[model samples]
Target: MDINIERLKSTLMELSKFGYREDDKGIYRPGFSEADFAARKWLMSIAEQEGFITRMDGVGNVIIEYHAEDVAPDTPAVMIGSHLDSVPAGGMFDGTLGVIAGLECIRTLKAQNIKLAKPIWVIGTSEEEGRFGGMIGAQALTGKLTPHQILTSHDPDGIMLSDAMRSQGLEPMEALSARLNPNLIDSFFELHIEQGPVLDQTGVQIGVVEGISGVFKWIVKLIGKADHAGTAPMEMRSDAFMGLADFAYQINRIIAEDGTDTTRITVGKAELKPGFAHTIAGEVDFTIVARDMDETVMENLAASCRKALSAIARKHKLMFEYEQVSWLTPMKCTPSIVEFIAQQAQKLKLNYQVMPSGAGHDSQFFTDITDTGLIFIPSINGISHAPDEWSHWHDVQAGTELLYQCVLTKAVNKN
Candidate 1:
């Protein structure tokens, strides 16, 4: 059990150094940002330094490989890792822990002089933070990406993904053309922070993920007349802000009453037209996001959103329109893989729980290519995507060990 817990912590800390931001209070390696490319370079340079053969696809995934003597290059390898990029002001461990732990798995396995029948590859996938609404690197590897998806995608800041990839020395079209055959990977494994209170409150050291939630997002605009704030009577004015406000007030009730307990609704952004001190707001713009673990429930939640907001707009005498931004169905991990993970936890004698992921992850994308499983460590106070985000080093070590042993055993069909 020479897993080197301190070594894992040090590697995580070192990764944190690349994407620090003073104003944001968390790491800001938004996809294709300068800091993200720096992190990418660091991953490649470090992999080479560690004596692992390094390579990249057109979408800028950094894969470090360990080839067993009898394993052919074309043989299906066991894939392990998560993404390297982060949301704006995101926590240090959100998508990073898996990659670091995968590296450690490779390190420990090589140190033990263990050889397998198949190769092992640890990847730091690029652009998984929804900056472009897709996990670019992982999808490219899984053959789930299309050239149109990349060429047409843009971040919130209006940066085209094509331009971003080119800036980092990758050709978007050619990189997509380099997609690996799905049959080449036996399975994919990822270890991540729980990012919720379940494991922390229950004192569970490991979480075997059941499935990931489906997400749907929309941009809504409420339109109304702008009038003089001092002269226009409140009763006579058709205020768009009031329309947006009314929806915000009733959203919780809508989901709770009309949808299931697992359904989640978020009004993540709001903007008032002509934001001024004394003028009546003429229009409102906002973003709506909904999530649920079941496809029908997810669709029902979407219908509920439209029902709730449209009624609010009618009552407020405001024109309303919403555009669907994205819709992704829930992804279930292979049951065999989940059971296999549970067996590993049992063998290790670690307290564990089988649970669903409220947040989407790269593992959801991997389900397209091969069996996928996720391991989660607890987040302190269930906090993530902020500078204060943390997982106890002990919990981190336990999750990593589970991942290490799982890969070493399962990659070779020893399961």
Candidate 2:
């Protein structure tokens, strides 16, 4: 059955208002913020009003499920959704689209009086914007969360995760209780905006994601003596910023030698200590985030980065140190599910591409636990995480329709 794009659009627009700002016309629902929590509660309330069974998990994931009378007990459920939270000043469609699309799928099924052999659950996962470590809700549901992470995690502002949870009336350690038995879930599906230029540039209507890239983050420090900018001889002074600049310049060469076409390395954050126009920078602290789909390539890239930094430090007469913050191995979507999604796309007469997602998503966490599929619609100008991020309504409908078709096939009894 086809999805109602108008209904989906209306719900999306209504949800966007929860964190919208007039200043920049952006949404500010960082994970576990007041806006994020309000959006979750609103979703649960809306689902309940529509005659669906809805509840919020301990970690704040909003679940709306459909279990008809004919569906047998102990049957596995088809869980479909994405995270509900967004980056600060993020666009409206980033993670919210997946959650809302899943909701629309359920609505369409109910309106058509479709009978189910299995239960279908639409979840709006919490804290996926990395304010206190991203994909918190998904990690909890898939049994990937650790008590250490829950207690020690903090945002960029130094607010602890436990404190954030308690502020929202949720106990910290209780997140562990949100995990579900792997067997209890039949499969998972997520429909999301491509958030990149590939599909949009290629004029493809759908993207059947094959895998997600592995990522590693490093916090690097380069230390040197602070000296008077004018008096310090250019040859004698040890400049930390020079070391950092040299490393940045080597990134392209590193990738060309040790990385693939898909490999990406970014120095996203940086700081110079003893900031003054008359003083040379005494220290430079920067972050290195690298991504690649292959584990070995990730290893090679990391090694090259370390080598480059060591050489740069020696050349600049600076001390070098780095901490490996986090490393997530690449994950592949279920082969069967990937093929199934492409086959369904062909049946729908939609142009499709099988590609890897450069960005992380909640579905990556479910790869080992159940069959998982991720559908992607084009993002206008390959933009996301900003107010300008957008996907056309027709693309949204097509992606949602594909999700619905897959869910119907899996949730309905074939007998």
Candidate 3:
């Protein structure tokens, strides 16, 4: 079955209007914003028009179910979905494309009058961007996030996540019930734009993701005594800023020795206390983000960071503290499902390759409970989370078709 490109484009264009930005290149709707609410309403309306039953879970995940009358109720449902939330000033096609593409896949199946033993569900998972550190709404559905986490998380404006959910008519406490009984879902699939230049650079139209990378985030703090910058001798001063500088330098050295093309460590955010040009810095705080496809490598890098901190503290006569902010284990896509997707790509005569995802996705969370797979279409220049990000309409259409093929195959084969 082939997706209707015209309809798919029209749907994307319509969705774009909700968070429309004249100066920015793509949409700008953050989670739980008024614009986000409007987009969800629009999606629900579309799902209803397609004769699908629409429901939103407690954490604001939208599920549109297409029932097969001839199928047995006990049969596992084939699920296809992605998140709807966008990063701050993100492009239009990042998370939204996967979701709309999933819906389009079902639309194609319905147009062809295809009947299957298992029902199909297209989902729009919430907050995959971690705007509030809640990923894909999967945390709630998978028991990875607690009500306390939701109640405690706040956006930039200090609007608590619980309040945001309440504003959208969702009960935060009830979000725990959103967890899917592990037996209900048979297999999960997500179609996404590559958000990187890999496929576009290689001229591949599709990507069958082998696995998603693990992520480790830390806040490293260096504490030292504050003193007069001019009066203090350079040799006698215990400068926190200097200590942090040396720490960052050592991190670079470690990365140089152990880092590969896929390994990455970033000190993205930093701060120095006692806002004064002449005052000796008393404390320095910085964040570290480390990612790798292999969990062992990730763990080793974390250990290296601790060693670096200890050595730096001993040299600088400063106290060091390393606080772990977050850690997500790597998840590999199911081999059978990945092979099935590759087979469909070949059958369609589409150019494709197997690859690993450098970024996290909602699919990773689903892997804890169900067999899951991911597909990626090219993102022009491999740019995402920015307005300049662009993916050709043809690529989106190709991805949607591949998604349909995979879903259909899984539904019929029950593997």
The list of candidate 2 runs beyond 4 A from truth reads 225-238, 274-279
In candidate 3, which residue ranges exceed 4 Å CA deviation?
23-26, 134-136, 151-160, 219-248, 258-260, 270-286, 310-322, 412-415
Candidate 3 global Cα RMSD: 3.2
Residue 13, model 1: Cα distance from true site in angstroms: 0.7
Q: Rate the local accuracy (lDDT) of all candidates.
A: 0.85, 0.90, 0.83
Candidate 3 CA-lDDT value: 0.83
**Model 1 lDDT per residue over 1-415, tens place:** 6698888889889999887977866898988778998987888888799789998777888889987777777888898979999987788999999999999998898888886878899989988877777577777777777877777776544588899988888877876765777878889999999999999999889999989988877878899888889999988888989998888888878777766766788887788888886888898888887888888988777787888778887887888898775677789988999999999999989989999998888898888778899999999999997889999989999999999889989666633
lDDT tens readout by residue for model 2, 1-415: 5688998999999999989999999999988889999999999999999999998888988889998887776789999979889887899899899999999999989999888989999999998767775788999999999998898777644699999999899999999999989988999999889889999999999999999988887778999999999999999989999999999999999999999998999997788889898999999888788999999999999999999999999999999998775677789999999999998888888899999999888998999899999999999999998999999999998998899888988899543
Q: Which candidate's TM-score is highest? A: 1
Q: Write the per-residue lDDT of candidate 3 for residues 297-352, one digit (tens) a residue.
A: 89889988898888888887899997675677888998888898999999999999
lDDT of candidate 1 at residue 184, scale 0 to 100: 86
List the candidate numbers ranked by TM-score, top first.
Answer: 1, 2, 3
* All candidates in order of lDDT, best leading: 2, 1, 3
